[model samples]
Target: MSIERERPRILFATDFSPWAAQAEAYALCLASTWRASLTAVNVLEFQPGMNPEYEVNRLFLAELMKGATQELADLKSRVAARGISLHTRIATGIPSEEILGAARAEDSDLIVVGTKGKTGLAHVLLGSTAERVIRTAPCPVLAVRAEPSDQAGKDSHPCAGVGLHRVLVPVDFSDCSLEALEYAALLAQRSGSSLSLLHVLEPVSYGLDFTLSLERKRGEMRERLTQRLAGFVEALAGAKITADSHVRGGLPADSILDSARTLPADVIVMGTHGRRGLSHALSGSVTEAVLRQSRCPVLTVRSPKFAAGHRRVIPVS
Candidate 1:
């Protein structure tokens, strides 16, 4: 398909699992809301030892392709019933690699995927497709987490109930976070969603004396953080966006999650440093933690101007 670059484009990768289907519904909601061009991609990946060249393997691969194509067609008809036009593509290779390639080929502004919402060493060690894509995607990536079993099939069409009442963002006065804040503003403008800014203060406690001092200064620190948070959202206010700021002292991931649940945000927009190798594994990412545990979907923006793995992108807040 000859896509026009002038219009915003969204790429959604679906493996046809129930979670991926949830992401599909979420992507459709965003595409319809933004009036952006939408493309759905699915990858047929095989084991390292498996090759399609053998006659038997070729026959099996052909069947899988047929099934995948039919699935995409079914998706088209379902989405089209809602009067939405969708473009679908199929690829053969590693799921994450093919998804990224499609995003680059299409010059997509956003890439959406579904995640199992698991975290810790095992998750990274296992190499999750959504995690890999978020770590290195060429553009913004929205990960819609797997719903709880009781809530899994509740909303086949999430658009009906998922209103954009509030968009929560964590600010740390860093360039990447500021960039994410700008993106949040754009989303708020598009969906008529209000903005909620949270700044988490990592307290330093050495001993009993230090603990007392830190407690005494918390109020003052919160005052200053509130001011800076307000400054960051000034542009948002100018855009005529409704915004509120909050500052808390604790672990960033815990604080952000608490605010998300209490505020009941529809989506969380945050910036990731896109750390890799030693730095990625060592530097404990605040964004990754939130992405894995938050009840709402997370939109992670990695600044393209920065070399993803070269510079130490400090995740602010």
Candidate 2:
């Protein structure tokens, strides 16, 4: 999708939690900057034991809905004060399922959800909804963490990215990565953000020693790949997007996280695919690790094609 060519529809699936409020700031920031219509949705999670069809349960549900409406109204007013007109909705059922449904139903161009990022422990357990939404959203998904990393908080405010300055995109020279670059270019165009492209190189064989010949070959490979990275930067030249790239040799996730941390990127834009078992230029495993460790929000572009287990073409939303 040409996100630059089209005005995108944005959906913020909020749970009214403190972390969700963090996500709201990002949704509001993007909506205000992009001038895109924003919708805030809250799902009323019905307990399995109580059926809403009964009188007591029905009244209880009514009370919750009444409260939610007021909360959404207050949130609307808050964003409206920032000159952003907000649309609101409340859904009933599973949070992740309902959120995915809402995005599907609305044909949203992007979905933003709040997450609490810390050391492992499943990373984001906003009902584990943030992780699920990242995996299966119809369009790009923005995972906004509750706060910045300790080191980052001293120097900057992660939530104040309404005026983005730098975007870090990890590329592995795959079609999926190419798609991510497209998304990043548009973001850079709109936000005047500089693009940092990273490519990580790993040893081709597990037990091989780095002999003189191997070192020579590695140098050749780095130069070749660096040229390819430059070609990508050249492609963005016409749009006047400031873009530069680098080639690093290490674990993909570690290298990516390092670049993002040192650059203090406002966001990391990359791509993910459902493909498993076989190796691709970039794997879901790498993306998952980056999402868990990065100090900034990760905007993941879903690739239309799949490999291995799920080989069907994904329909555009």
Candidate 3:
């Protein structure tokens, strides 16, 4: 995607929870900024053997729809008051499935969703609809979390006082990372923010011996990585985007989060490998860890053709 293109359609999945409310504010702000079409979706999960055709299930479904409709209506009014039109949809089925379907149906360039930010056992046990959507969505996904009580009480909207001052992009020089860098550059250009490119060089200690040879090899690797990162930054020179590069030695996810917090970035834009099932379990996901723990919003983009240089850059609106 050309970095100069605009995002015309944005899909927002909500459950009407406080976190979703916070995400709505971001969606609204983006819609207004980009003058993009906004579509709000709410999924109504259906239980097995609970066909709406049955009287009992029918009543239950009806009540649920009624509440959902009212919530959407209220959301519509709020968005409209902000001078942005909202298109709402209610679907039945799995939350992630419905959200992805809506994105495909709308040809959306981005999907915005709220995450509960659950961690540890709670996250593992319950899983996350936002994470699933991120894994499979055809477009980029923005995961927003509810503001802390202290912060929430001060701001009417989590993003109302926010501006994209600095954007952090973690890159490993993989195709996915390259694509993410392109997107982050465009976003920084549009928002007048600087870009921080971080490359974490995980330590490698073979066979328990920290020999001088191994130390020399590690130093050589670091030098090469630094040069590559410089070249990566140089590629964005013509775009007039201010970018800085950093190479750290540690775990990928930990380094990303630490840089984000220390830089006090407004957002973290990175590429997701979109690993799932066994692969996901075994390899885990650095993007997911950063998404779960980062203080700012995280945008995850997965594109098969992203590295081909044939894709058009969709604006972050």
- State each model's CA lDDT, in order: 0.80, 0.75, 0.79
Sorted on TM-score, best first, the list reads: 3, 1, 2
Clashing pairs in model 3, backbone N/Cα/C closer than 3 A: 1-311, 1-312, 1-313, 2-312, 2-313
Model 3: lDDT equals 0.79
Task: Compute the lDDT of residue 306 as modeled in candidate 2.
Answer: 22
lDDT of 1: 0.80
Residue 14 alpha-carbon offset, candidate 2, angstroms: 0.9
Task: Tell me the lDDT of model 1 at 106.
Answer: 88
The best candidate by lDDT is: 1
lDDT of 3 by residue, 1-317 (tens): 22244556889999988788767767876776666788999998885566779998788888989999999998887776666788999998889888999988887877999897778988777679999999988878889865734343134442475556888999887878877877787667656788888999997758876689988988999999998878767766656778889999898999998998887688899999899888887788999998888778898979622334443332221
* TM-score (all chains, Cα) for each model: 0.88, 0.83, 0.89
Best by TM-score: 3
Write one digit per residue (lDDT tens) for candidate 1, span 1-317: 11112357889999988888778777888777778888999998866688779999899879989999999999898788666789999998889989999999988888999998876677867758888898889888999885634453245463644556799999888888877877777677667899999888987757655666667777788888888787766756766889989988789999999999998788999988888789877786899889889888998988533222422212245
Clash numbers, per candidate: 0, 0, 5
The superposed Cα distance between candidate 1 and the true structure at residue 118, in angstroms, equals 2.5
lDDT of 2 at 18: 76
Candidate 3 C-alpha error for residue 180, in Å: 1.2
**Where does model 2 exceed 4 Å of error?**
47-50, 54-60, 118-127, 148-163, 204-210, 275-284, 304-317
Model 1 misplacement above 4 A: 1-6, 47-49, 148-158, 208-216, 304-317
Candidate 2, residues 160-241, lDDT tens digits: the string is 5343688998988777787777777767766678998889897576355658887788889999999988887777776688
Residue 23 displacement (Å), model 3: 1.1
